[model samples]
Target: MTATALPRLCVVIPCFNEAANVAPMVARLDATLAGIAWEAIFVDDDSPDGTSVAVRAIAVQDSRIRCLKRIGRRGLASACIEGMLATSAPYLAVIDGDLQHDETLLPRMLEALEGGLAEIVIGSRNIEGGDKQGGLTAARQMISDTGAALANAALPMRVSDPMSGFFALPRDLLEEIAPRLTGTGFKILLDILLSAKRPLRSLEIPYSFRARVAGESKLDAAVLLEFAGLLADKALGGVVPLRFLSFAAVGAIGLLVHLAVLGLLHGLGGVGFNAAQWSATLIAMTVNFLLNNRITYRDRRLRGPALLRGLVLFYLVCGLGAAANIGIANLLLRDGVLAWGLAGAAGAALTVVWNYAVSATLVWRAK
Candidate 1:
């Protein structure tokens, strides 16, 4: 390819802490995509291990290599979206930076798209020629299988591996559905398929899911929760924002905490009702703030001093929320309008709107 020639394909590798795999991934791409004009964009979420530096080192030597280092924000789906949008390449492929995904499938995926055989091509592990056992642990495999099953149930068309992260699609198709994408989790492929206005013409290619040669696997229990949030976000057709759904889910858990604490303090410890309620409210608010930081606003998660500051702000914000909660519950208790438990639940419910609205704007506002 000449220096002035435009790439026909752009491979977007969303990564963090995968510096060791950088050179090898580029070498693999160079070997496999011999006749193709392609570029590799490594979207690093400001990896502490200097993954961006590694990419830039190679990029200085090779024009086709590029680095997009994101600061103070992170998520695979969002990284891939940003990388894909950074290129003018006609076709876009998303492969992992950990080298678990087969880079060899890029050409095949591109062919399927260019030949009009598919609108989106997925490198599937569940297919006959593919293998997931090669890469995933037993627990991870089970999680993948269960998630695939659940995703397929909700998908417009049944997919053998809706959980597969390795996939490719036309840049135009991506642009078409980009506006609808939640860009919140690991399953960008699922987000793409679900967000499409019309059922996309799809093809699945078989590829062995390779074991990682460098960096730790980013998959965790939290990722599953994010996946669930993604499903909920799409299922509602984006009526309720994704972050709000996560906030509400955390709020539900907080309610459980509040009730448990209330029971322990008031029922078991013989504390006064008002005192127990206040104690439970404060404890629940703390739990909710921590969980919200870890999950709901994960991309904008605060750390160190910021986390401390955010916690203080959260307490102040929810303190007002708690006031409304206690006031309503006390009024109901005094008037005999409802049982204690029901009154408490109603008060908590009313405060969710207030806390979520205020906290989102004040505490977790993007930095």
Candidate 2:
């Protein structure tokens, strides 16, 4: 009896200073993926230790194993990119050298992809029957959870676990997104989501996050900062644009800026009311402009003469916006502070829409 043909699978492991864990992790993966038409490519990021040497030794015995030694110290993201480019398989998988990501989930992940249940199958700790290792401290878990939440808040699609580095994706999709993949390390999931032309189905497989059998974990403060920056970038990409209530929050800040300027000019500066009004309004306008530019209209581009034109139009729109805000605020203020706040918020939201259109068409002009 002849054995049935298996699907072609390429497991790309990104290794950085993981000599101790790399060999064992490679062996485990080889054993795990034995049934499939699998090739394990270990892309080493110039580890000081002899990780490449060990992988090379193993590759001599096993035709399925190959090692890529980048003499220049490349990062995890780049290593993955290099491995993906080198492999010749329709289905590709990414895993960490740390061994925190389970190799046991590889078959099931491939199964999910083969069944057409998901274009990308993630081995998720958040899923049922999945567990994190001892290294995952309370603070670390919270930080990870918060990051995932923020990412979901910005993206249109919600994956139960977006932070998982261990995932399988089709080579075609990877090639499509390869051009736009940001330097934001480790969060390739976001890169895929933002760049993929087709909708992605996801599978949350159960697996335990294991301890590194040999080397230390590489996560650091700098990596966390990079992650936070990625989250901020995602937010600025019109993901959830602070929502309707966020406009009100900006208005409230604007009010504080306005009142503070007004009081300084009138009470202490002793400037006349009309002159003070213009001064205070101008200061408030600057504050609002900065806030909206940073938060509400962040994704919109601004350049050239169009930026100046947009600024002029934004202020003009603000005057109409202010009148509407005041009218609604007054009517709602008669009822309550919350109502007045809501009404002012509504007005500010309308103005943001006005700002978005003019900015998109004229200033930044991002299609």
Estimated TM-score for each candidate: 0.92, 0.61
Q: Write the per-residue lDDT of candidate 2 for residues 1-367, one digit (tens) a residue.
A: 8754433999998887777776688778868877688888899866888888878888899777889888745556767877887876889999987878878888888887888888889887776788864558787788778778876776667876787888998888788778756534567676567556455777778788876667876664445555665655554653543323344456678889999998999878999989999989888877776665555444343456755676776677677666766776676677775665687776666666664555445544434
Best by TM-score: 1
What ranges in model 1 sit over 4 Å off? 1-3, 326-350
Candidate 1 RMSD computed on C-alpha atoms after optimal superposition onto the true structure? 2.9
Cα lDDT, model 2, residue 37:
85
lDDT of 1 by residue, 319-341 (tens): 89878999999999899999999
* Residue 337 local lDDT, model 2: 56
Per-residue error for 135 in candidate 2, Å, reads: 3.5
Cα-lDDT of candidate 1: 0.91
